[model samples]
Target: MTKKDDHKDPALVSIGSMFETGKIRKMYTLAELYPTRIAKSLGINYGRYMVKLNHPDKFTMGEIVRLADLLDIEPDMITKVIYAELN
Candidate 1:
């Protein structure tokens, strides 16, 4: 099976497809428009934060909200990406 078929998570596949299609590029750009400078202001470690939220680390909704705020994007966008990957 191809990698897409191997992926059990449709949301993740969807997000991946979105990226492959360049749909997420703007969002990614927007998210990173501000560097770690903002994260530092919030006492957040950018890489560690992503690892915590995206992988082994569990992130609270509040933390997600804080991240969204720091990234200057709606929390829903992040949630949508996650939910898309999960469901």
Candidate 2:
């Protein structure tokens, strides 16, 4: 049987690798998981959601918690990424 990845387009895999550095970016996570749906769940428009993602420090405590729940990740994971990016 062919490996699942064997069917993947080489060009697409190469481009995907370019974005898969060890560090995970918040925008990438949100974008990959459907930003529009997330924005609606957060009661905000896509533009505002994008702005908040671009400026991590602008996120409120409730938003942080809600995002963690939505993303199925620990709250600290999100905070750490934001802190690391800022520092």
Candidate 3:
């Protein structure tokens, strides 16, 4: 996906919603618990996109997978968590 196409993905809003409502804080906690794997799991873009929030964290559904792996949960659970918070 090109840089321009990123803005078009609904997953962008999903990730943004997770962050905005503080749900991503749990993902952060899981990352913290497994600090050693942080580098491989989060990588450079995690920081880059976090502030700008356009890092394509949802690109290829990677963020959801990452959160699921890190939290010892499922990707669907991540979506459910973020969605639940919205309501």
Best by TM-score: 2
lDDT of each: 0.49, 0.62, 0.45
TM-score quality measure for candidate 1: 0.44
Off by over 4 Å in 2: 1-23, 26-29
1-87 per-residue lDDT for model 2 (tens digits) = 123334544433332333344246554455554678777767888889888888889888788766655544456766777787788
Instruction: Provide TM-scores for the models.
Output: 0.44, 0.65, 0.37
The lowest-lDDT stretch of 10 consecutive residues in candidate 2 is 11-20
RMSD of each: 13.2, 8.4, 12.1
Candidate with better TM-score, 2 vs 3:
2
Task: Please state the error at residue 51 of candidate 2 in Å.
Answer: 0.5
Worst 10 residues of 1 by lDDT: 1-10
Segments of candidate 3 deviating more than 4 angstroms: 1-40, 49-60
Structure candidate 1, residue pairs in collision: 11-84, 11-85, 12-85
Question: What does candidate 2 score in Cα RMSD to the true structure?
Answer: 8.4
Model 2 residue 74 distance off true place after TM-score fit, in angstroms: 1.3
Cα lDDT of model 1 by residue, 1-87, tens digit: 123234234433444344444465233332443435544544767775545544412556876665555444455665665555555
Q: Given candidate 3, what's the lDDT at residue 1?
A: 15
Candidate 2 has an lDDT of 0.62
